[model samples]
Target: MKLRERLEGKRMLLTGVTGFVGEALLHRILRDLPDTHVVALVRRKGSLSGRSRMEQVLNKPIFEQVRERYAGDLSALLDARVTVLEGDLSDVPALPNDLDIVIHCAGDVSFDPPINQAFQTNVLGTEQLLRRILDSGSNAHYVHVSTAYVSGRRRGAIPEGPVEHDADWRTEAHWGLAMRDRIEETSRAPGVLAKLRRAAERDHLRAGPITSAQDTERRRKEWVDKKLVEAGGERARSLGWTDVYTFTKALGERVVEEVGAPLPVTIMRPSIIESALETPFPGWIEGFKMAEPLILAYGRGELPEFPASPDSQCDVVPVDHVVNATLAAASVLPEPGTPAYFQVTSGARNPLIFARLFDLIREYFDKNPFDMGERGAVRLPIWRFPGGERVERTLVLGERAHKAADFLVTHAPRGDRVRKLARELDQQQRRLDFLRRYHDLYRAYLETELVFTDDNTWALFHGLDPEDQREFSFDITTFDWHYYLVELHCPAVTESMRKYDVIRRRRGRSAPQVAKQLPQGEGIVAAFDMDGTLLSSNVVETYLWLRMPELDGQGRAREVGALLRRMPGFLNAERKDRGRFLRAVYRRYAGADFQELERLVDDSLSQHVLERVSAAALRRVREHRAAGHRTVLITGAIRPLTRPLEPLFDEIIAADLAIDDRGRCTGFLTRPPLVGEARAAWLRRFALQNDFDLAKSYAYADSHSDLPMLRAVGRPVAVSPDVTLWREARKGRWPVEDWKTSSSVSRLTLPGANGGSSS
Candidate 1:
């Protein structure tokens, strides 16, 4: 097959020119029929950014062949044979003139698509294009790309011919259970971060267990319904098409009949098509639609449970075969009064057993032996989401996804099983929202005994020689569904996994995990703070203000806490700059503490630290330990004042005096004469005298007064930041971060300490 032969003088018009089938179709057209002119209709108003939708669509890997043919010089084709018109199908007077052929390959194919858009393009668009073709008077052949699922209302053995019956479109629920817990997401909307966060959370959730069988089934159903709402299905009614995509596709067939009564039209319908194997190329797939779930769920060990019967037949086709059928239909068929119908499908005479498909995929994965790194392959149970009478067995299965998830989890340390469970719950909620918003069509796609017949197609296939059959036959009988599925399923899922970069699987060696191990070496000084930043007290707690009146010096202690809690809300607003700033600070300094000091802060001092432990302040102690850095807790508050928070740090250097063994107050300062320049001054001198590395030591505080103390360290991190340190950071561009930036955490511990205790 070469391009210079057929297209040497012919001209063609192609819509959906950048789509999966369209791209493949164009490549085949160019190769088999060279010198042909191709006119690609692209939207002028593209990404709503600046990139042309054509460029965006062509960037996908599926369009590689087409892109290569054009050699990035689509303009040459545009100026010569390929002209990219900046117009939409819905726009009228679609054709400038008439052509030899009009290949309309554009239309929504989502099984669970929206109600309205389904008909707008599938029906109305097709009719509009037909009218233009008729008006051209160029005696052009019109070929439409329709899905096999267009048999929306039909069941059992489907024929291999164009269906002309008026279809009853489904506008309401498939199962008729009103959904109540709808989460409004803006991913499909204008904003990006809102969409990103939602996407992140959804990814986070799916990483967990499905909980119970009932829950899994319910989610699956919801997922299907969710997909229906995404495409313009609900919006297409105004466009005069039926409400459902499948029904509308059937309707589109009739629309062709009405307007294109005399024009040459071919309705090419293909069954569930997978990747190619022999012809053209082997294993080239675009997405994970159709049978992706069966393979992936099974691969992850989550799909031992079946939704449909094992005995059912799942007809599938190869992309190359579909391409061949499409090309052959276009090149060979002569223009007739009624359109030539070709069903490129599978089943009955050309069926592959669904049970065999599932069985082989499972067998291959088990025997193929590929290491997915440290976590190993996804742990599968004999059954998924088991419970009640089999609760104990379920427990073991669940445990495997948790504790055995050792290599699976990353970034965050493996903890109690409850942690994994909590993460799972949070993630599912987000996924539910995402499914409802962005993937409505995916959610609404119906699952039935959906099978197609291709008697006419088989005849066409058999008419050709055995070699021709290999080249042009789309006969489903020849397909090895197992090979097709694994080849098709792996790339999409793998691409998605790569895009998400989920290192936190229940297995695998995580990126440089630094656990907050108990501190070993001794520290010289421990500095701490009270109020929300330290003891987790109410921002306006008067006792805190009274002790650190300097915080009131600018009304900042409360100000900083207020800023941190409002972080997430600000990320989506015009004030994102402020949010970015706060986020940075929280990361570098929020948990800046000495690990060695944590036990002391917890045991000896925490109980008497004037109040309960502040998880925020305790975090600082853990960080220093995690870094193997020595620490000294310094504060203006009394020793008993920070007692509860004491074990979290090394030594307490407080304003309060310590009692000797004689139970007498020693007026001598535990801290050296370290104040103002004397603070950085004496601290540096004392550290050196005591063999403490001034370059390695760190100092933490909650006030502008601590600037000198901060400068004494190699790294200066400001927690929940203040106006003073915030300015210094900019001048120096010091490292900043917000601790909460990593993962959405459980409830933040509300502050409890009063009278301000600093560690």
Candidate 2:
């Protein structure tokens, strides 16, 4: 019988219609078997209904061919033959009584998920689904989609049959689910809490006590997640499986055998599914799959050497082939109370060696290298196929060297040169981390010795009519490995990478135009951070500009030497306590005449301070003032240095220096410095006293020390932020902007100044 004819006029219920393989199968069935009615079971995402999500999925590129065939009236076709059900496998909804087939394609696919999470979805979820089907009283043939890796760590030929395991599925499921509570209980032990609290204190030293406690709780949750992942991996390995995913999948198969009674069952296991061959379109893939990450890493010159033998068989099948095999398996109903097994694989029939695959990737990259902007075209690295132990040793040594370099850079004197070197070191560390992660995740798969056999799958393909075989062929022997790797798969991955790059660039360039226009009235305020956000100069630079001119050549040399000797301590203090660092810095002004400093600030306002101000920041401040929003300059720089810029803002809250009776600086602050949590607290109280609505206010900062202040406002903008602040901004989806210094401008300006620009 033809494949389509066997499936025609049937009512099918399909789960995981939103995933890659499930979506492809649904498209194939809808396009080929027009008379068939399909009930698509999909889980609702955040704020999006399952039906709405399905509409989005149908609009993907994978469904373009079918959409065109229906003349862009895919909605009409869906209305006629498709039924979208909002449900999940853990809690199965009502099943159709007249169902002809049930394709179970939904399960957790992550390799190292938490033990309970994997068991709940892959094992218990499957059991629940089977029981629901039985309750519906529909004698539908159940086809469960699984993975070939369920054969586990056995290093030999794997047959198309049930996995041999002594562990009972019920006991494994119960223990896995119970492990979560045990882990959570252990996480609250005194020793664990003490360790996490110490780490959090170090991380949030400048943010105050409340922020440190919050960080401790966050770290505790992270520790629990890490422990769960480790426990899952260990248990999976104990059961002779590579990871939790395959172990739970094996248990899922056991569920099918034990729970699916008196009903025909078929198990379809596909190996390492990749991009499509020729079905919907060439080089069509939804997202990055198993091999694409490593491929792209190699193309980008990030992976120096891999841990795999040259003779190892790399079993990879296209998604279209898997989809076709699944449909074919679904078309043929097995005998009642009997389970049929089919392994959709390419290892036994036409094996592609690791060396050959590497060569093809190298050749493709050599012809069309990745464009890495200023770094020039990427040069492919020669794969020596080093031993796993040796590769691991190299990574460890590289990490050690990277840490030493980071320490040296951190303690070095702060300047443009040192900052540049620090950025370079950060980039290299990220690349090194990527390499380590890739090796840890994929080393086992790359060096595997097991090969899956597909005798039953081949027989099913041969049983099809000649025309049907031509239309739905999954013949691995006829596939062109070179063409697929070089022309289709690699290019698809590259396009996906390019799209991601475009998104990142857009994020970096996005402006705060929306935030500026959102609120009005005097109760709305705009807060600005001074040192790095609004000006290129810092407290040290401003102090130097005032104090350096007072000394001659030898005195100036002594002053610079003193500052150099104290730089390390200053940096340490700044990292741990920004307020303390400001106090220490202000001490350098002792014994200097306050009147003389004021005169010097007036003389150098245009050349030193005003020239360092960012034009973008100046414009944003004016725009806020023009809209009747109060403008506040909150900085740690001393009041003397900021006095000239008072015309630009309604309020300037800066550090004030204590003076002796003779007007000489007393080397102490009149009040506590406004920084970190203290600054956030001041902002809150100021808002309450002035009737300002903080939820309608904006705050701009550049350093992680200002995280509390940024969080206190409704709209936070990170202006040329540091690494830690940048990471926080990305997580919060806060807007980031790079403000460059306006070197040509020698005056400060505002919207409603009495004399226009201030000098």
Candidate 3:
């Protein structure tokens, strides 16, 4: 019988209609089997109703043919032929009395999900659905969609049959489901909490106590999740499976055999399903799947080498082929109390090795290369197919070196040069992290030697009528690997990525601009960080510029040599306690004539301070002043250094050094340094005293140590931020900008001045 003839008047219930294969299957059934009634089981998401979600799915490009056939009245057709069920496999809803088939396609496809999540969706959910089918008393053919990798860790030809195992499904399900609570309980132990808390403090050092506490809790949950993933993977490997996903799926197959007895069951397993071939248009795909990330990374020149043996069999099938095979399997009802198995894969028939696949990908990318930002078209790398172990070792060593470089760059003095280096390192780190993640996830599958035998599937295909075969063909023997990948799949994936890039560009352009959207009022204050925000020069540089001029060239050389010798200690002290670092740096001014120093700073203001000021930052300050908003300069630099820029701001809150009766410097701060929590506290007091609304005020800073100050205001911009501040800004979704020093201004040299100042 033809597939449509068998399923013409069938009442079917389908799960996983929102996923890649599930969505394509749904489109095929609705378009081809018009007379069939389908119950689409979908879980409600947030505020969207199940019916609305299904409508969204039907509106996708895969359903374009269906939409055209129905003359845009797809909604009316859906009303007549489809019923949207607002539930999942875990909680099966009431089924129609005369249901003919139940297609369970939903599953967690993640390789290393938390154990509890894996079992709840894959094993127990299947058990619940099977039990529901038994209770419904409908003699429906149950089609269980599973992966071909369920043969787990086995080599050679894998036949279409039950997986050999020594463990009980019930016991495995019990342990997997109960692991979450155990991991959560362990995460709350005193030692664990302390460790997590310390890490959180280091990450969110200047983000205040409340923010740090919140981060600690977030870290605790992440730790629990990580432990759960580790435990699940360990359990899977112990039971001879590659990962938790395959292990739970194997258990789910056991559920179909044991709990789903007396009901006609057909288990259909497909291997590494990719883009569509013909049905619902060629090259149709949803989100990025198993192999797309690796392919895209290679095309982008981010991945340098492939990590699989050249001759290893890569068993891949198109989504449309899988969909057709599923429909074909649904057509044949098995004998009562006996389940049939079909492995819908191409490995045993026309196999495509890893080498050929890589060649095809490279060919496609060579013709139409991926855009590499400033580098234009990416030049594809020559893959040596180095073994997985070698590639992994190289990535590990690179990551360790990256960490050491990161440490050195982070502790370097806060300046434009260091900031640029930090940004470059951040980009490299992200790329390396991406390579590591995909390598770990796909290494086993790419290197596996198992070739799934699809004898049962081919037999079933041969039994179909010629016309039916023409209409719903899934013959892997006739599948052209070259045309499908180079002509269809690669183009489709790159097009999708291009669309995403467009959306990202639009979002970036739409980000909030602080200067253009400032409110006008005295209560609205605009706060700016002096060192890296307004001026490219830091406290150390400003001090050297002022103090070095007062001494001869020998004194200047001696001062710089001493500062370099103590630089590491200063950076260490700054990391441990900001106030101590400030005190130590200011002690160099002890015994200096305060009046002479003040005069020198005033004389050299235009050369040292004004020349280094960022033009964009100065314009923003002027805009705030013009709008009648109070502008404040908050800095850790001493008060004398800020005297030059005093005219731009209404208030200057900087460090003050103690002066003796004769105007000699005491080098001791009269009050604690305004940094971290102290800066936030002082801002709150000032806002209260001046009747300003902190919620309506604006603050800007570049260093991570100014995070508390940034959080204290409504509008906080990160100006040419360091690595730590950049991460915090991204996480908080705060505005980030790179304000360069005024380009038109030249570096001024004072007559008889010695070496360059340190920054």
- Deviation from native of the Cα of residue 48 in model 2, angstroms: 1.9
What are the models' TM-scores? 0.55, 0.86, 0.88
Sorting all predicted structures by TM-score, with the top scorer first, yields: 3, 2, 1
Index of the highest-TM-score prediction: 3
Candidate 1, 321-418: lDDT as tens digits: 78777766665455666777787776666566646665667666665433455657665534322322253343346545554443344323213343
Q: How well does model 3 score by local distance difference test?
A: 0.85
- Judging by lDDT, tell me the better candidate of 2 and 3: 3
Model 2: per-residue Cα lDDT over 664-688, one tens digit each: 9999989999999988999999999
Indicate the residue-level lDDT of 410 in model 2: 55
Weakest ten-residue segment in model 2 by summed lDDT: 750-759
Summarize candidate 3's per-residue lDDT along 299-398 as a digit string, tens digits. 8888898789999998889998899999999999898778999999988988999999999999999998866455688888898998999999999998
Q: What ordering of candidates by lDDT runs from best to worst?
A: 3, 2, 1
Q: How much RMSD separates candidate 1 from the native structure?
A: 15.0
Candidate 3: which stretches are off by over 4 Å? Answer: 68-75, 194-215, 373-376, 414-417, 498-524, 540-568, 585-612, 638-644, 656-671, 680-697, 711-714, 730-759
